[model samples]
Target: MAKITLKDLSHSYLKTQSSDADWAVRDVNIDWEDGGAYALLGPSGCGKTTLLNIISGLINPTKGDILFDDKMVSNLNPVERNIAQIFQFPVIYDTMTVYDNLAFPLKNRKIEEDKIKAKVHEIAEMLELSSTLNNRASGLTADGKQKISLGRGLVRSDVNAIMFDEPLTVIDPHLKWILRSKLKELHQKINRTMIYVTHDQTEALTFADQVVVMHEGQIVQTGTPVDLFEKPKHTFVGYFIGSPGMNLLPCEFKGGDVMLNGKKIETHTKVKSNNFSKTEIGVRPEFINFSSEGIPVKVLSVSNTGRHKIVDTQSQSGKIKMIAKTSEDIPSGSAFLSFKKEYTYAYGDDWIIE
Candidate 1:
C-alpha cells in the first residue's frame, strides 16, 4: 500500500472557459494515508468518478500531480500505477466456470498453480460461492457475477491500491449489506489501501473509514463518519449527509444571541463576526423537540419509522421538523418547538465557524 497525495488537482472538460462552471473538478488537495480506507462520496456529476479515474491512471489530470508513496504517477498508465479498479457491473467470461473466472487473473500473472488453487478456494469460500465453483459463469446471477469481479480485484495482493466505483449498484438491498460487511472484514484482514466511490450515503458511511464529501467537482470535507455527522464543516455537508438532513434556517448572529423571524434565542459562539452576511442557524431534527416555552409551529405530517416518529411542522419562520419517540398525545394542532443550544450551530453564509 502507498500513501496517495493529490496535489493541486483540477480538471475542466471545456477547453477555453473562464468561469467556475467550466470546470468538472476544482483544485483539490488531499492526502490519503497508506493502508487507509476512503470513500469518495457525493451526488452525481460531483466529480467522485473523475477523481477515481485520475487516481487509477485512466485519465491524465488536466492540472497538478498525483503521488503514490511519494512517486509521481500523474503521467503513468493504469498498469504502472499498480491499481485494481472494480466497476459497477461485473466483467466476466461466459465460457469460463466460476473457479476459472476467479483463477484467470492469477494464471495470467503466472502465479503458481497450487497457490492459485489455494487463493481461489479461499476467496470462493469467503464469498459463499464455494459450492458453485464448477458452475459456468453464464449461469450465475448478477450478484454472483459481481462477487467474482470483487474477488478478482482482491485476489491480487501486490497492487498499491484497490478502487471500487459504485460496484454495488446492481446488487439487491439485502445482499448490499452482506457485501459491505464482507468488504469491511476483508479490508481489516488485508490492511490494503481502498478508495470506494459512491453517490449513496449509506454505502459510503458503512464502508469507509474516512469519507471525502464532494460537490460540484470540489471536495467539501474529508473526515471520519462521526465527524461528518456530528459537526459538518459546510452547510451543504449538513444537508447532504443526513436522511431528512439538517435544518438550516436563515438567521443573524448578534453577539450571544441568534435572531430568526424576529425571535431572538441565545446561541453559543466564541467570537462574533462584524459582517456576517447570510447567517443561518442549523440543528438536526433529532436535537430539536416540542417544548412549552419556545417558538410555535403547526404540525403538518407525521411519519412512524418503527424506531421513532418524525414530526413535520410549519413554523412562523419556515418549516422545521422534529423526531419524537412516540406518537402518544403529540398534537397535530399548533404547538411550541425548542432547539437545544448545545447541539445548535451558527453559520455565516452556509459556512461553519472555524
Candidate 2:
C-alpha cells in the first residue's frame, strides 16, 4: 500500500485552455493515506473519472505532480505505478475460466503455481465465486464477470492501490448492494488503499470512509458521511448528499442574527459578512419540523416515502422541504416550520459560514 498524493494537480484536454471552463480537473491537492478507503463522488460530467484516470496513470495531468509515498511518479506508466484499476464495464478474458481469470495477475509476475491457487481461492471465497471457479467466463452473468475483474485486482498483493471507476453501473439493484457490502468487507480484510469513483451517493457513503465530493471540475468537500450530511461546507454538498437535499432560504443578516422573510431564524453559527453578494440560511429536511409557531408557510404538498414523509411548503421567502416521521402530524392548509438551532447553517454566496 502507498500514500497517494496529488500536489497542485490540474488537467485539460484542450491544448491551449484559456479559461477555467476548459480544464477537465482544476487545481486539487489531497493526501490519500495508505490503506484508507475513499470515494470520489459527484454528478455526471463532474470530473470524477478524469481524476481517477490521472491517479492510475492512465492520463497525464496538464500540470502538477503525483506522488506515491513521497516519490514523484507523475511520469510513471500505469504498470510502473503498480496500481490496479477496474473499469465501469468488465474487462476479463472470455476464453478463460474464473480461476484462471483471477490468477492471471499473479501468474504474470511468475508466482509459484501453488501460491497462485491459494490466492485465487481466497479472493474467490471473498467474492462468493468459489463455486464457479471452473466455470467459463463467457458463460457467467454480468455481475459474475465484474466479480472476476474485481478479483483480478484484489489477487495482486503487491498493488500500491486499487481503483474502481463506477464498476457497479451494470449491476442489478439488489446485487449492487451485495457487491458494495462485499467490497467493504474485502477492504477490511485486506486493508489496502482503495479509491472508488461513482455518482451514486448511497454507494459512496456506504463504501468509503472519506468521500471527496466534486463539482464543476473542482473538489468541494472531503469528509465522512456524517460530516457531509450534518455540515456541508459548500451549498452544492448540502443539496447533493441528501435525498430531498437541503432547503436554502434567502435571508438577511445583522448583528449575528438572521432575518428570513422578516422573521428571525436561529442558527448555530454567527455569520457576519458585509461584502457577500447573497446570504441564505441552509437547513436539511431532517432538521426542519412543523411547529405551532415559527415561520409561516402554505403546505404545498406531502409525499409519503414509506419510512418517512417529505413535506413541501411555500413561504414568502421561497419553497422549503421538510422530512417528517411516518407518525408525525401534518396540517392541511397552513403551518409553521421550525428549524433546529444547531443544525441550521448560515451561508454567504454558496459556501457555509464557519
Candidate 3:
C-alpha cells in the first residue's frame, strides 16, 4: 500500500488556458493515507473523475505533481504507478471464464500457477462469484460482470492503490447496496488504499472513511460522513450532503447578533466581519422545529415520507423546510419556526464564518 499525494494540482484540457473556468481541476492538494478508504464526491462535472484519473496516472496535471509514498510519479503511466482502476462499466474480457478473468493479472506477471489459483479463488469467494467460476464472463448479469471486474483488481497483491470511478453506475438499484457492502468489506479485509469517485451521497457516506466533496473543480470539504452532515464548512456542502439538504435563509449581521426577517436569531458561530457580498444562515431541516413563538411562517404544505413528515413553510424571509416525526402534530394555516441554535450557522460569501 502507498500514501498518495497530489500537490498543488491543477488541470486544464485547453491548450491555452485563459482562466479558472478553463481548468477541469484546480489547486487540489490531498494526502490519502496508506490503507485509507476515501471517496471523491460531487455532482456531475465537478472534477471527481479528472482528479481520479490524475492519481491513477491516466492524465498528467497541467500544473502540479503526484506522489506515491513521497516519491514523485507525475510522469508515470498507469502501469508504472502500480494502481488498479475500475471504470464506470465492467472491463473484463467477455470471452474469458470468470476464474480466468480474476487470474489474468496474476498470470501476466507470471505468478506461480498454484498461488494464482489460490488468490483467484479467494477473491471470487469474497465477491460471491465462486459458484460461477467456470461460466463465461459474457453470460453473467451486469452486477455479476462488475463483480468480476472488481475481483480482477483485488486478486492482484502488488497494487499500490485501488481506484473506483463510479463502478456501480450500471448496477441495479437493489444490487447497488449489496455491492457497496461487499466493497466496504473487501477494503477492511485487504487494508488497501482505495479511492472511490461518485456523485451519489449515499454511496460516498456509506463507503468512505473520509469524503472529499468537490464543487466546480475545487475540493470544498474533506470530513467523515457525520462531520459533513453536521458541520458543513460551505453553503454548497450544506446544500448538497443531506436529504432535503440544508435551508439557507438570507439574513443580516447586526450588533453581535444575526437577524432574519427582522427577528434576532442565535447561531453556532459569530460573524467576525460583515464585509461579505452575500450573507445567510444555514440550518438543516432536521434541526428546525415548529415552535409556538419564533419566526412566524405560513404553512405551505406537508409531505409524509412513510417514517417522517416534511413540512414546508414560507417564513417572511424565505422558504423553510423541517423534518417532523409522523406522530408530531403540524399546525395548520400558520406556525412559528425555531432553529436549534447549536445547529444553526452563519455564512458569508458561501463559506462558514469561523
Candidate 4:
C-alpha cells in the first residue's frame, strides 16, 4: 500500500488555457493516507473522473506533482504506478471462464499456477462467484460480470492502490446496495488504499472514510459524512448534501444580531458587518421545527414520506423547509417556525461565517 499525495494538482485539456473556466481541475492538493477508503463526490462535470485518471496515471496533470509513498510518480505510467483501476463498465473478456478471468493478472506476472489458483479462488469466494468459477463470462448478468472485473483487481496482491470510477452505475438498484456493502467489507478485510469516484452521494457516504466534494473543477470540501451533513463549510455543500437540503434565508447583520425579514433571529455564529455580497442564515430541514411563536410563515405544502413529512412554508423573508414526524400534527394555514440555535449557522459570501 502507498500514501498518495497530490501537490497543487491542476489539469487543463485546452492547449492554451486563457482562464480558470478552461481548466478541468484546478489547484487541488490533498493527501490520501495509506489503506484509507476515500470517495470523490460531486455532479457530472465536477472533475471527479479527471482527478481519478490523474491518480491512476491515465492522464498527467498540467501542473503539480503526484507522489506515492514519498516518491514522485508524476512521470510514471499506470503500469509503473502499480495501481488497479475499475471503470464504470465491466472490462472483462467474454471468452474466459470466471476462474481464468480472475487468474489472468497473476498469470501475466508468471506466478506459480498453484498460488494463482488459491488467490483466484479466494477472490471469487469473497465476491460470491465461487459457484460460477467454471461458467463463461458471456452468460453472467451485468452485476455478475462487474463482479468479475472487480475480482481481477482484488486477485492481484501486488497492487499499491485500488481505484473505482463509478463501478456501480450499471448495477440494479437493489444490487447496488449489496455490491456497496460487499465493497465496504472487502476494504475492511484488505485494508488497501481505495479511491472511489461517483456522483451518487449514498455511494460516497457509505463506502468512504472521507468524502472529497468537488464542484466546477475545484474541490469544495473534504470531510466525513457526518461533518458534511452537520457543519457544511460552504453554501453549495449545505444545498447539496441532504434530501430536502438546507434552508437558506436572506438576512442582515446589525448590532451583533441576525435580522431576517426585519426581525431578530438567533444563530450559532455571529456575523459581523463584513463587506460581503450575500448574507444568509443556513439551517437544515432536520433542525427546523414548528413553534407556537417564532417567525410566522404560511404553510405552502406538505409531503408525507412514510415515517416523516417535509413541510414547505413561505415566510416574509423567503421560503423554508422543515422535516417533521408523521405522528405530529402539521398546522394547516398558518404556523410559526423556530430554528434550533446550535444548528443554525451564519453565512457570508456563500461561505460559513467562522
CA lDDT scores, all candidates in order? 0.86, 0.93, 0.93, 0.91
lDDT of 2 by residue, 1-354 (tens): 799999999999999988999999999999999999999999999899999999999999999999999999999998889899999998989899999999998888899999999999998998899999999998999899999999999898889999999999999888998889989989999999999999999999999999999998999999999999999998999999999999998999877789897788899888777568989899999998889899999999999999999999999999999999999888989899999999999999888888
User: What's the TM-score of every candidate structure?
Assistant: 0.91, 0.94, 0.96, 0.94
Better of 1 and 2 by lDDT: 2
How many steric clashes does model 1 contain?
Answer: 0
TM-score leader: 3
lDDT of 1 by residue, 51-118 (tens): 99999998887899999889898989987788888898888889999999999889988999999999
- C-alpha-based local distance difference test score of model 3: 0.93
TM-score computed on alpha carbons, candidate 4: 0.94
Residue 170 of model 2 has an lDDT of 93
Error of 1 at 102 (Å): 2.8
> What are the clash counts of all predictions, listed in order?
0, 0, 0, 0
